[model samples]
Target: MTLVVFLLVPRLHLLDLAGPAQAFSTAADLGHGYELRYVAEHEEVPTAQGVPLRASVQWPALTADDLVIVPGWRGRFAAHARLSKATRAALVAHHASGGTVASVCAGAYALAQAGLLDGRRSTTHHALQDELAARYPATRVQRDVLYVVDDRVVTSAGIASGIDLALHLIAVRHGAADAAKVAREMVVYARRNGDEPQRSAMLRHRGHLSDTVHRAQDLIDARFADRLPLAEIAAACDVSPRTLTRLFSAATGMTPLRYQQTLRLERAENLIAHGSTVDAAARSTGFDDARMLRRLRSRLP
Candidate 1:
């Protein structure tokens, strides 16, 4: 099992901790063997929202397969708000020992203080990018990106970008399919990859709150590789075929069958990229033959 340790600083932003924590926790729920731990400079720390968080003051032994993350905090520019010397040393030692180190939002300051970001490409919240660059001249600060992964050190933009960072980690350690599963369970409409446009079919047709459409989507999500009849799909969602079609279209801008086809095409393309033959990819993705796959490919610009 891989150990994921979160190093919480005082006045931590709630979402900076919760978003990534929830992603990893959901991955565990989905049967990934991950062990999560939380640590801090003190036994009890206060959050930016005025809530007290309890954590261990002691650090745990970590290995190369382990991950250590620093969630962002408020008052990043305050002298008293800085990470303790012990915490900085811990982060430096972890990275030197080949363990992965990550930071969310202003937490990048902690990693920089540990000398982890020196001569490395990193990023912080857009509003603090200039400050981070000015403070750490050796670090290359990337702007307007969701997150950056350079070497084994990861850093993300502010607030909700932590979720994207965590999901990207899942994709790296597990697979894209596993990441997509976690994002779907979290109801995340889109998983942004740096500054790239939306690419994952699992996230493409999302961003609405229709229970009927969601029910239908759940069916397709779970059984995308199987041949599901429209009537059966409609029945599972407790609606007629026509009603299901209309609702699905209204919510996702695509018919149920089209959605299924998109899922199949995307999966098949992944398979093909990984060296699967057209016929094999077709069979794996529920297509009758390579003809349909070829036709779909031809239609793409």
Candidate 2:
């Protein structure tokens, strides 16, 4: 099982910890091999919301598949927050061992303290962007983006954006379909990737209140890489093909086939990025030939 460890600091923001925690917990519920653990410099820590959080003072052993996250705290200046030297060393060692190290909002300061953000592309809450940049001259601090993933280090902008960061991680580890399932179960729209205009298929076709449309979408999401005809999708949703087409178009601005095509295209692009050839990616994503894949790629802005 992959372990997800949270480094809870004093006065940590409740949402910063809860948002990502919930995302991982939901993924676990969906049968992902995830185990959540909390560690802190002290056994008991107070949150910004006045809730007391209990954590293990001792750090846990982590593997390359494990993830360690630092949730933002309540201080006006992150530089003022005190992090134990042991914790800093642990963060550094974990990254060196191929583990992922992530920070949310002011939590980036802690990673910066551990020397993980040096010469890395990272971001924090907009209000603290200047301070994070000034303090860590070697780190490139981006502003206005939800989150950034540089090497094995991830940093998110603010408190709520932590959810986006976690969902992105889930997509990277699992797949877009699993990530979308978690997002749908959480009733939250998956945010677009910071570097991509095309959103995840899970979120791209969400936001409508039609049960029929949603049913069709669920089938499409689960079997996008299969050769599913519109008639089969319509039959599964208990609607005529013409009626399903109209409802889906009105709800998501795309036909059911188009929605499936988008999912297939996105999956193909990811496969290609990870060293798969055009023909292999096309076959893997349910395309009969690379011609359609190349045509779709040319249409991307």
Candidate 3:
């Protein structure tokens, strides 16, 4: 396989760079025909922590290939935006020509900026979930699974989720058993599909929302069982109820009530599945009524 990865300068995490690089290299060592190339916006790229990276090729030099990996950018995503216009255009063109595009963590931001994620499901670091959805309303940002493969595009959650995703791709291209051997060599257990929640249970902050609104969300999360109204939350943020509803919905896909319900139900499901009873799980997740919880769960399925 021939592959070229585009790393954002001044923000590429070492692991994101090394994970796929090592995966393909090991595949080659294991008798698979694989070639990997790492490119960047400039000839000499530097990480967010100032570790200099020697790019194999610059942006202008990159051309179409079998696969292109975009590593997460470093620093605050809003502060450190995605690729330059030319680079973004090139990526769009490359994907349009039938190439696979994969992103780890903040790398999804670049893909979203290029409009590649529109109407597709993707993921990133759980902490940036709200920001991602706010920026790309057309994109369905999933947080509960390790990675989601939407056609030719694949996206993983923050950090080590990249490893899981990389191994998955390797398994798909080569074989699961071969990928398992590689993962064992790397000291990571071979994980199967849907092995873990892709998204964190914690809510993310939207940069555009006020600090007060952010605090309000934290409060609601902490006390999900409390019947807090939108008016109460808005008052806490010194905003009108309508304003609060709009901002919260914009930050997250659902309204405040829906977001709270989703979180509560997620917690309830986790608690109910094992040794615990349904009532116990419901109570643990702040639902006083087990019937209500079961109704909600039934609706979801």
Against the unseen true structure, what C-alpha lDDT does each candidate score? 0.84, 0.87, 0.70
lDDT per residue for candidate 2 within 1-301, as digits (tens), equals 9999999988999999999999999999999999999999889999989999999998888998899999998876554467878889999999999899999999999999999999999999988999999989999987778888787899998898888789878876776778888888888863543463324666756877889998998888788889898899999989999999999999999989889999888888767755689999899889889999999999987
- Per candidate, the number of residue pairs that clash is 0, 0, 5
Please provide, for model 1 over 141-171, each residue's C-alpha lDDT reduced to its tens digit, 9 standing for 90 to 100: 9888788877789999898888878877776
TM-scores of all candidate predictions against the true structure: 0.70, 0.87, 0.61
lDDT of 2: 0.87
Compared with the true structure, the alpha-carbon lDDT of candidate 3 equals: 0.70
Clash pairs detected, candidate 3: 143-198, 143-199, 144-198, 144-199, 145-198
Better of 2 and 3 by lDDT: 2
Clashes of 2: 0
Instruction: Flag clash pairs in model 1.
Output: none
Model 3, residue 249: distance off in Å is 45
Candidate 3 per-residue lDDT over residues 159-255, each given as its tens digit: 6777777776665554344665566467564343343653333322233345555555666665666788888888877889898888777765567
| Candidates in descending lDDT order | 2, 1, 3
* 109: Cα error in model 1, Å: 0.5
Preferred candidate (lDDT higher): 1 or 2: 2
